[model samples]
Structures are given as structure tokens and as C-alpha cells.
Target: MSVLAHLGVEITSSTDDSMDNRKRPAASPNSGSFVFWSSSFRRQPARVLIVEALPPWWSDTCTVLCDALDNFLSLACNLDGPSRIPLLSLYAVSRQQECVLPFVQVRGNLARLHSCVEELRSIPGEGCIKGAARGGELLRQAVLDSLQQFKQYIRHISTGNQTNNNLSVEITVVTSQPGPGIVRQLEMGLKDADLVSLKRLLVVQINSVGDWGQDTPSPETTYTEAEESLMLGTEVELLRMENSVFALETMLKAWLQEQGGDREHLHLLLPSPTDSPNPVCVKCDMQERLISPALIPLTPNLGVKTESVRDFLPVTKASANQNQPPQRLKVIKLLRADGLCESVLYGLPLVIRPTTCWQLDWEEMETNNNLFHALCHTLRGRDLFLLLQVEPAGGSGVYSHYVLQSSTSLSLLLKPVVSRELLLPCSMPVSPQDPVPDAMQTVQCCLTQLDEEFVFNPLSLTNNLYQHLKSRGLISQPRYPYRLQPAAVLRDQSQPPEGAKTTGSRQPRQVKPHSFLQQCEGHEVT
Candidate 1:
């Protein structure tokens, strides 16, 4: 969360090629504790600039923008994590561009943002001043100019040596210009702009309710042509909202959350050679994949919602220490799988993905990525698991976890394990009676037929309640939200899966799989 690379010492004392290593609390193995990596890298905070592209002097549009900004600031302040906050700026384009506010971190500068909204509201709407820039040309100029300003700011930061000038730049353009013609012209202008790509740009188009129809909600639209026009790395997301201020504010808030409202970050040390003193570490974003459900207190009125009871409940000293020491993933040991193993999971499950730092050189970033991929590959290929000492973020206790490959990417599952000594003796006999040969053969045949007949997709699973609420219009859903995915090895243990289909001939599946083993069947114990 802390982009302290610029503040920390260099990784090595003698070499210039060695990168800067941000200092963290190192775990001492000599004390019978975990041995954690002392060095780490983190992605720079996102620099986002919101562009107002409504027609000049349009009071109604300006008022909506101001209200939306106010609500957005309020919502952002209530978020729990400070590290996920992005630096936000705003620019209004009329006959000429207006810098309503420079880039400022949203968490502590809420008052400044509120004042900026007031300033936006005070702008006199003269209703389409003569000879003012309008349409796609105006938008084109605004985007190009914004990019130039971002580059200038980064250069200035580098000159000042305050921090690494590697911040992720994102520009969100909110325009009330209705119709597809504006989008088409914008695409053409972008194609001619010398820039390579606009991957970080987001264009939100607001339209009137009457334009789409009064009975049905407007459908979201994407401008694939706009993305293609600029050779962007990712598809351009085009969000359409009705003219209602409430709807605009609600949609904008949801978009900001999707950017990264719920993620917590940690540095994971990759497995290094025993002789090497320092191991390669990469930045990772941790997210709650599965959380325990809690009973919500009922409210007397539908408009009045109940807040979390945790506020009224007592807060322990541990919970109050929001700025706890940063967490590190340390490999305690590696063991070969003998047979089926069982472990208990008692806390919320987390999914971790190794993220690339933009500040590092291309080769260095690739090396870190490759290291993570290789680690996961070895664990899955050799039928092995890693014993890790993990400290969960925003919680107490040091829990041991069995780290296994969770997906094709450098994403791993940390399943909490309890000590064997805590379990009592089994009530039944240690060994079961041998199965009949005839029955074993029949079961094997059935399993084989089922495997061949259907190809399993782990992504099919979804939270029923969440989806139900979304479908019932009770919740707003992002166009592309995160979903859980099982590793390729889980689909077929014999060989790696290809294009969601297994290629190897069917073999008798293990009757009792290890708790960490994700079976081909849809069933999962934890």
C-alpha cells in the first residue's frame, strides 16, 4: 500500500543494477518464527482525472456533476482501506478547458473536493456560448491535453525526486452529449492523435431517460471501436447513465469502488535458492473471495438501512491498530503428498494474485512474474504443497496454510490448517474393509463416463444471493466484476487442461482427495 520504494535503501550495497528495496520488518527464523523477506515492491497509486464534457453553460448538467461529486466524496470517505484510494483530479471543458482542481488524494482532502464541487456549481451556464469548441473535437482535445498534462506532472515529480514517476494514469470523461455520432468522431480523432494507447481512459456518457424509453432501464454500452482506434491494451468501458442526478451519483460511486475499493495488498517472497541471501518478491493484491455471512438487523422503514453491529460492539486493542505491521508470505517447508489429507478452515478465505509493478524495468518485472508462475507450476506438477506461515491482514493470530495453485495465473489459495495434535482419535476403525472388485469397476466406469460427457467449468459457480439481488434490481452490478476460478490442474490431474477441456484418457479418480486438492467434480468441502 505504501509506495515507499523511493524512500528505502537500494537492494544491494555495491551494485547500481540492484533495485531499491523498501524496508519491512524481517522475521527471524532463529527465534523459531517465520523467516520473512525484508524487501518488497509495490505498484504506484492510480492518478485519475475526471473530465466534464457537457455542453458549455448547461446548468442542469453542471448541477448533476456537482451533486455526483459530493456524494462520491461521502461514499469514498466511509471505505475501510486507505491504501486503495486513488489520487483524483477534475477538468471541465467548455470553449476552453478549466482546471477545477488538481490531483489530490481523496481520503484526507474531502473538504477540498467539496469546495471544488461548490466552484463547479458557481460556473455560470450561458447555454452554448458562440464559437466555443463542441462535440467530438472538444472531447478529443480534452483527452489529448489531459494526457500531456499527466506526462508533465510525472516529469515534474521525477525532477523533484519525491517518488518514482510511475503512477498509473486514469482519465474518466463524463459527457452528456447524447447519440453515437460523438463517439464515432472521437474515435477518429483519437486514431490521428500520436499517442500509442488510451488504456487508462474511461468515458461515461449520460443520456436523458426519455431518449432510451421510460418503461425499461437503459442498457450499458461499450465502444469497441474507440478502444481499437487508439490501440489500447484493454477494451474501453463506456458507461451510460440516465439524466437523473441520483442515478448518475450512484453509478459513479459504484465505478470508483470497482476500481479497487475492497482490495488489500501484501508482498509475497518467492521461493529462492537456499544459498541466495535475498529472494525475489512481488506485490500482491489480496481480496476476500469468500466471507462469512452475518445476520443483518432489520429496520422499521425500507428507506432506513441498518449498519454493522460491529460499530456498537467493543473494539479490541488489536482491531484499533489499523496501521499494523505489513504482512509477508514465508515458506516454512515443502512436503510431498502421500495420500488424501484433511485440514480445517476456520476464517474467511482470501485469493491472492501476484501483481506487476510498473515502476520496475520490463525485464525485472517479467522475471518476478516468471518466478511466481514457476512456483505454482512446480507445486501442481510434482503433486506437492507448501507449508506457509501466514498472518491474515486486518485480523489477529498467526495461522498456518497449505499453499496450492489456485489458477493459471500466479494466483494461489491459502487454506488455513490446524495442528494435527488438536484432533481427537477417530471413532471408527483406522482402516476400512476392502471394496468388492465388481463394485470398484462399476464406480470407475461411471466416473469415467461422467468426466467424458461433461467438461467442468469452475467459473460457473456464483453467489446465489448476490446474483438474485442484482437480478431483482436491488443491487448495482459492474459490467465486468471479479469471479473465482479453479486451477487448471483441478480440472484434470492427469495432464494440464486446454481451453477448458481435458485431453487425457479417463482414469479412476481418487476416492478421498486431500483438502487442498480441487477435484474435477463440482463438490468442494471448504
Candidate 2:
């Protein structure tokens, strides 16, 4: 209940936001795919018009994206494609009311790209996506990839929003059009999106407020309606967003570089008439960071380094006091007194808000992950339990911290406990924080060594591995490592020194750790 109270967004949990033709569905996911299909009550060709938030540099993105997709599709057609093709944005939405879910929308410009998969090219305004500052880029590529894959089904797509940074694509379906017949041609294409909103939500009625908690498991509320629509995410993204602005400035300076002809008042995202840096994608940097671990260590780079300062202490009598056993986290078990949480029988939705934490004691310690993994491995068939620790650090509140064991069966997550609370704390933030206590007041789960080895997710066990690397002197999670490149729009003057490479300067090869041990002591990395 208090989880969002500190954030200052006063939400009426039980309040209903229902309308005449619409009844709010129960919650499923915070992030969901929408699929929409429209057969007009009055048979008529759906004329789609795009709306963009009107800004100094607004609909320009729509024009640039539409034209770019058009040109790309034109190029794709040369390779021999299907008889028909359409281009559309996979995650586009109509007026907010059209689809009643967050982060789900209609196709953007489906008219030109959906005809042939081979002919599908640019995803409109896709390069403008971002995530949380620390983990913002986490889901950007996934979203982009989904868009590209959906391009083949875009029969007609365009934008209409112009007062903000959001991009819109209004789609209409009428049988009189020349393209392929409805249904068979678009069954898979419209699985989770609407002709006007998202393809995923087309036929699926999602819960209104519950979608965020159920549909999307992503932690960051970083995706919002403001700059979120533009993707300048985090304080880290501000600089890059500004670079995009600068690139727009350069295009304004001249007018013949884009289409090889002078077209005054060009779109912001299009190549400017001026010879500024070609528009490099804001998300193009993703290729290098795949399979990258999220939890980074500070001192030297070993992540989740359980290798504490005590590891180095000798066996002398004086050292015994200094080398105490790694403290055990407090344990509180949240048992579901009522069956409200453990039941997931049908497609009917369920919301599992916490009343308290479940606890377990740490009898001993071992560095095996077989016991903790959630997906595949030894625990695939059996119901595997995992722990989620909720803490109160930023503000002093009475939300007692406890532990609850959750299991996934039949594709739905269920907890046996609903009416319990536990109070716990840690010496540090689950993320980054100022450490005041050496000992963590954790309410952790207890698993046997064999149970842990066979069940734990190897990734979770390696949590302490971050500090292991750091002690040896390795860089932590460098999502935005020092050098910042705003956009390709700037000249040598605008890029950070790291982004700049002189012709004579040989790019140094990254030194891989000879062994995890050596990297621990090789050099200092923050």
C-alpha cells in the first residue's frame, strides 16, 4: 500500500475508471502487447491520419519516419517480395482511450510496410526509445526488434499526434481496399495489437490499473508520457537527447543534403540539408552489451562479491574477532492463511498485493546457484521457490520487511501467503546506496546445499561475484561508461573525448581478464 505512497502519485486502488462500452478488466501485466481488428459498423475504407505532439520539432519525426520507411520499403521491393506489403509501427496507440493498457498501442504507419517481410525496412521513430538511467537500455532493443518483425504486416500507418513527443498511427480497415482480404492475411499480424492501438490488445480485454503489476515485470516506472515518449531517459540520456537537438540545428543550417534536393522545413529526424553527422541511432549501441550482467561491482568489478573483507583475515587470536561469520539474514515466512494468492485456475485475473513478508533462517552458507534459479535447470519440473526482499531505506516507514516464497505453475505466479508482514533491512541499498550498517538485517530463504545446487539460478548465486571482480580491480556495470555521445548531429566539438578517435589513435583492445582472479587485483575500476 505504501509502496507508491512515497512517490506522490495518489492512486485510488479500489476506484473504478469504467465507461459505457468498456468495463475495466482485472490486472495482468504492466507491459502488454495489444492486438486490434476493426470491421467498421458502416462498411467504409478506414482513412488513417497520424497525429504527433506539436513541438518545435514534432511531426517532423513522423514525416521523416514515414518517408524513411517508404524509401526503405521501396528498396526492399526490388529483391522480389509478396504481392502486397504494408508498413506500420507495432506499438502504436490511438487516442489513449482506444486501448486501456500502458505501453501497448496500435501500428505506426501500417500502410506502407506490411506487404512483404523482405520489403520491411525502417521502424518509425524507433531509434528514439530508452530505459531507466541505470537499467533504462535494458528493454529498448527488445522493443525495437518486435517493431521490425511486425513491419511486414503494416498495410497503412501514419501519425496524428502533434502537441507532445508521442507518435501516433491511426488505422482503418475497410474491405474495399486493394490489398489482401482481411483475417487470413492479418491473423498473425494482429495477434496482440489493434488496427489503431497495439496488436496484442486487439481482442484481449486487459485489466485497467492491474496491467502494470501483472503484464510488465519491469521495475522501472521510467516509461512515462513526458520525455518518455521521446526516450531521452534518465539524467544520463539528457546529454544524448540534446545532441539529437543539435543535429536538428545542423539540418536547419542547410537544405540539400537529405534527398539530394532543397526541401525547406525538413523533418527533424531526416538527414539535414546541411552535412552534419548522419543520424546515428540512439539505441545503436546495444550490439556491444548483449549477455551483459546487470549487477555491477564498484571496488574492482567482481559482481555480488560475497568475498567480504573478512575473507582476508588470518587465523590469529586477534584476527578471530575481526573475522566473524558472515551474518545470517533474519527470516520471516508469509503463509497464505487465505487461498486468495495461490489460485490461478482460468484466464481470470488476480492481484497479489503484500500484507507481510515470509521468513527463513540461514543455517549455513554455500556458493551454489542450483537451488535458486527460476527457469530451467534442475528445478524445471518441481515448484521452485524464490525470495523477494522489500526494504524501506529512502523513507522511514512501518512496512515490515519479510520473506515470501512464490512458485510458478501453469504459467502464473502464485504465493501461498497473503496475510503476513515481516520487518527487515540490509546494510546497503538493493541498488546503489550509502552503507551505514556492516550487517544486513535480511529476512532470507534457507535452502539445503544440495537443494541450492540443484535449484538455484546460477545467476543469482553469482550476485556476490560483482564484488569479487571489483576487489581484483575491474569495472562494474558500465551501462553508460564515462564517454557520452549525444547524437551523430554534433561535430568533433560536441562529442566526449572517449567518443572521439583521431585517425592516428589506434583504438586500444579491451583487455579481457586472464582469469577472474587476476582481474581482481590488476587495476582499480569504479
**Alpha carbon lDDT of each predicted model:** 0.48, 0.25
lDDT of 2 by residue, 1-526 (tens): 0011111011112222112102324323231211111111111111121222112222234343334334433322221111111122323221111111112221232233443212212223232213211111212222333433334223223225312111222232211111111211233223343233222211111111111123332333323345334421111110011213223222211110111111232233322222334531212110010111111111222111112333222223335336443212233432342332221111112223221222332322121222333332322344333333333222333122222333343222322111111001112227677544521211111111113354545456546667787865545455433343346634644444885656646563444545434655685554
lDDT of candidate 2 at residue 12, scale 0 to 100: 16
* Runs with alpha carbons beyond 4 Å of true place in candidate 2: 1-328, 334-391, 394-526
lDDT of 1 by residue, 1-526 (tens): 1101111111211111111222222323332122121222133334454555443425557767677668767655433221234456677776667777775556546788888878777767665543222444666677777667766765676565466523556667776555354455455556556454233556677763223223221222234654545643433457676667676665554333223323445676554434445654556753221111111111211111112223212223555536333345568878665442442332223455656656689888888888888887787777676776654332433243444423445666554443331121222346578878975654454444332426456577676987787787644654422222347655555465566665457574444454434454456567
161 in model 1: Cα distance from truth in Å? 6.2
Please list the Cα RMSD from the true structure of every candidate, rounded to 1 decimal place.
Answer: 28.1, 28.4
Candidate 1 Cα misplacement greater than 4 A, ranges? 1-57, 77-80, 129-133, 160-166, 194-198, 209-236, 254-526
Estimate the TM-score of every prediction.
Answer: 0.40, 0.17
Best by lDDT: 1
